[model samples]
Target: MTSLTCDVAVIGAGTAGLAAERNARKHGARTLLIDPEFAGTTCATVGCMPSKLLIAAARAAHQARESDLFGIRTGPVEVDGPAVMARLRRERDRFVSATRKDFDALPEGTRIRARARFDGLAGRLSGGQARLILDDERVVTARAVVIATGSAPMVPGPFAALGDLALTNETLFDLPDLPRSLAVIGGGAIGLELAQALARLGVSVTLFDSGTRLGGVRCDRIHATLKKAMAEEMTLRLGVTPEPSKDGRAERIAWEDGEATFDRVLVAAGRPPNVAGLGLETTGLRLDDHGMPEVDPRTMQCGDAPIFMAGDANGARPVLHEASAEGAIAGRNAVAWPAVVPSRRKTPFTITFTDPPLVSIGEDPDDSAAIGSADYGNQGRARVEGRNRGLARLYAAAPDGRLIGADLFCPGADHLGHLLVWAMEAGQTATDLLTRPTYHPTLEEGLRGALRQICRAVPLELPGDSDPGQPPGL
Candidate 1:
């Protein structure tokens, strides 16, 4: 049997694993990256990039259909399903190819295209090294190991019985053409985005979730607004648990009150960590009931061992940027070993790329003094563009009116979320933000209006009365 040794060995070559491997090498440690398939990252290959490509196409078709509201009449907005899928695949391949190039550019002999598992018998050696058994019968020992194997989509048993009729994000983009009708089985970010995109692409979409909430939105006002906007496009069956069964060539989704048949079911159910076959029992570390090691978010270390867990595998923050940051921390600590230092994490930010996107940044204070809100129903830009149909709320701490968190379900939410996150991170207060100039007929005006509301509630003393009269272009 072949044997290999390295200072750091990273398992799984996804975003987190790649970041860990790169950072370990940057720290002057001999690092090895292992993955059964070095195709690309989850984001580029299946998660973000490809999904966005489909959303982009759907946006184009939607805009064309809605152009009539702007006093411009157009012919029937026809979406060529095959053509859309073709472009999505073409562009998605480019992204995947780029990621593969990055993997190929790694130092020769450092990238191993093999599956690896912990050596159950050896565990951790007395020298603080861990042994890994590769699929090719090669044994590798490393001073520190980082597990970034990522996660896999969870398909319930009933849906699994439907065979190929059930699709997950990993396989949805491979469809040659869009299905006639689709039932999305989750109301989180993935389900909301794909259901809307498919609906806009002329597919009959019915979205179901056991809970009434959509996208895990914290604010009730934002949830209500988002649900209304989404309902205008497709059927939303919230607060219902659906049972899937075979109905000839199609799938039948029956709930407490109603039953419907769809060409296919898109399972946006949560993805658990892909840790089943990694042989974690052999790691000589304590594992939780779910087989996850207790990882320190600040240090990314698994217990006191020289092993680390990052990204989705840890089930902390599953976002791409968070995964990358955690991987870096794990990699650096893996190289530093016993002298690992804790790293600070960024403000929590999440966005669902729906029509009027849903975004949440930072944590909502438990005892918020005031909540500033803006309604898009009559916002100048929203009314002018004929695309506005949502709400935005900014939370403030008591007394000082410090901007603590924000939940937005409105146009330019993606941009507004970033701005609010930066402001919160910089410790900006409501009165402090109100001092900034807001452009005329822009989405920032909505944020400014919300900030003004906060100032009113807290009665903060400012350099000048920032709550000026709203003029058309002022």
Candidate 2:
């Protein structure tokens, strides 16, 4: 058996693993990056980039169809399913290639192409070092370890029984052409985005979720607005668990009341961490009910041990930015070992890429927080753009009027969410933002309107009314 030694051994070569290896090397630690498949990051290969490409094509078709609203009469917008898939695959491969080039540029002997498992017996003999046994019987002993093995899509038993009739994000983009009809299970970000995109592309889509809410939006008003908008575009079966079974060559999904057949069923339920095969039982760490180690979010450490877990492997935050941030923290601390320092995390921000997108930033509002809202239906810009549907809510702490968080389901929400989170991180109050310049007839005016409402509810000792040029002490 071959033997290898390194200061840090990083398992998996996805987004988190790559960041961990790079940061560990930058911190002057000898590192080995191990992965059986050297495919690029999930974002480039499957998760973010390819999904966005598909959404962009859907947006084009949707815009062409909706052009009549702007008084511009247009011919029928026909979607070429094969051509769409061709472009998505072409662009997705280019992104994957770019990431592979980065891997190729790494120093020789830095990457190990094999599956690694913790050597249970060696953990007792190697002092504080982590012992990993590769698939080829090679042994790796490292001073510290980073588990960034990432995650896989969860397919429930019913869907899995259908075999190739079921699809997840990892296999969704590889379709030869768009299906004639699709049943999207789970109304989270992945299901909502793909379901809407496919519907715009002329596919008959029906979305089902056992939960009533979609995209994790907590605000009842915002969720209602989103549900109304989505219902107009496709079928929605909320609060129902679907059972999938084979109907000849097609797939049938049935709930208590009704059933429908589709060319394929997309299972977007959830993705659990890839920790089962890593032999955590050998690590002597206390694992939770889900078999995940007790990890410190600030330090990315597993208890007081030299082992660290980051990114999707930890299942804390599965988004790309959070994965990258956790990887950096785990890598730097792995090198520092017993003297690990805590990292300050960024304000929480998430956006669902559905039409009239859903955005949530910072913390969800508590009952004690002052609430303010703006209806896009009356916003001048939104009305003019023919997208005058949705809502925006801003939350602020009482007395101080400081911005705490916001949930937006309106036009230009992706951009609006970023601006609001930046202001919150900068410690700016709702009244403070109202004093800033807001251009007329723009989506930002909606934000300003909400801020003004927030200023009215919170007890701020302002110079005058929340709006400018108003009487003092009004």
Candidate 3:
């Protein structure tokens, strides 16, 4: 048997744990990073990256099919599924080679193959006793621990007996052939994005959501347009519940009038934190009523007797990105301070990648006494790019003039996310954005226009001196 110890034991290699390890190494703390098998999951190898690759391929396929709309005539476009998958793999390998090197190449870093749970004295291995296991064989010891384990796709209630004949985001892309028809169990982010993607791939898709509306992360301003766009592509089974078919052929969907069957079912309500087993009790880590490790928000610390927690395992939503950020903070605190203070710089931003992806920045829309905003219906770029289909909703401070939040639904969403993220972080008011000129014809200018209108409605402080049409000093 082999035994080792480190100053910090980060128990996940997913987004947050990996980030934590990098920061810890930078601070010269000896780090031990552990995960069950691969160092990646939905976000890296499977979930976000691969899903986006598939979406891009689907978009290309859509373009080829709709070439006549752009005055390019061609024969019918067919999908080369295998080649598309190969491209995804080649790209994935290139990405892994680069990003994985960032961690595996870290000096003084230790990675163990086995999974360790909290044993009473120290983490124990089978038949190896450097430290004694709990009398009941469930406890372990560590100087300090951070749980950065992330979340997984939620399983649907109707498919309770679904051992097979089911797909979650984790396993959906593993198919060699696309299903003829897909019944999406939930109409949240995953369902909307995937339904559109599969529909473009020539699969008949039916989206089922219990609410009267679809798209869980939709904004009030663009919700109707997004719903209409998606409805044109797939069956919109809104305001309905689905019961498991007796034979599991398809969901027995219950709507106001009738029901039907589908070839495959996709469960995509949301993500649940991956918190089970691992024996949190040995460290005296207390879980909230939800059976997740409870932590102090500012410090991201949890567990009792020298333990801390981060990531989805602790029940954080908007999970991955936050977990990665929180994990770095938690890991650094666990090593240097040991006093356990956790902090993050900015509020979380979220996106849903349907056709014309939807992005959101700060405060919830339902909040009372709404702040000032500008919508992007009247931008030149919108008309030029042929996407007058989306909206940009901005929110700002009451009277002091600070940008609070923005939710964007439009084309080029992947690029738009970075722009909005920058604006929100800089506390750039609508006036600030307008002061910075965007190029003549681009989606970005629409963002600038949206800001200009919002500022005109409830004007914020301007540049020291301004021209009527140009940004400061331009």
List the candidates' TM-scores in order: 0.96, 0.96, 0.86
Query: Candidate 2: what lDDT?
Result: 0.89
lDDT tens per residue, model 3, 302-397: 633345667766665554678777778877776754465546556667778887887777767445222433344555665554555666676766
* Per-residue accuracy of model 2 over 286-353 as CA lDDT, tens digit each: 88888888999999999888899999999988999999999999999999987899998988999999
Q: Comparing candidate 1 with candidate 3, which one achieves the higher TM-score?
A: 1
Q: List per-prediction Cα lDDT, in the order shown.
A: 0.90, 0.89, 0.67
lDDT per residue for candidate 1 within 417-436, as digits (tens), equals 99899998898898888777
Q: How many backbone clashes does candidate 3 have?
A: 10
Query: Looking at candidate 3, what is the lDDT of residue 19?
Result: 77
Off by over 4 Å in 2: 121-127, 461-474
Give the TM-score comparing model 2 with the true structure, all chains together: 0.96
Cα deviation at 265, candidate 3, in Å, is: 1.3
Cα error, candidate 3, residue 19 (Å): 1.6
Stretches of candidate 1 above 4 Å error?
Answer: 120-127, 463-474
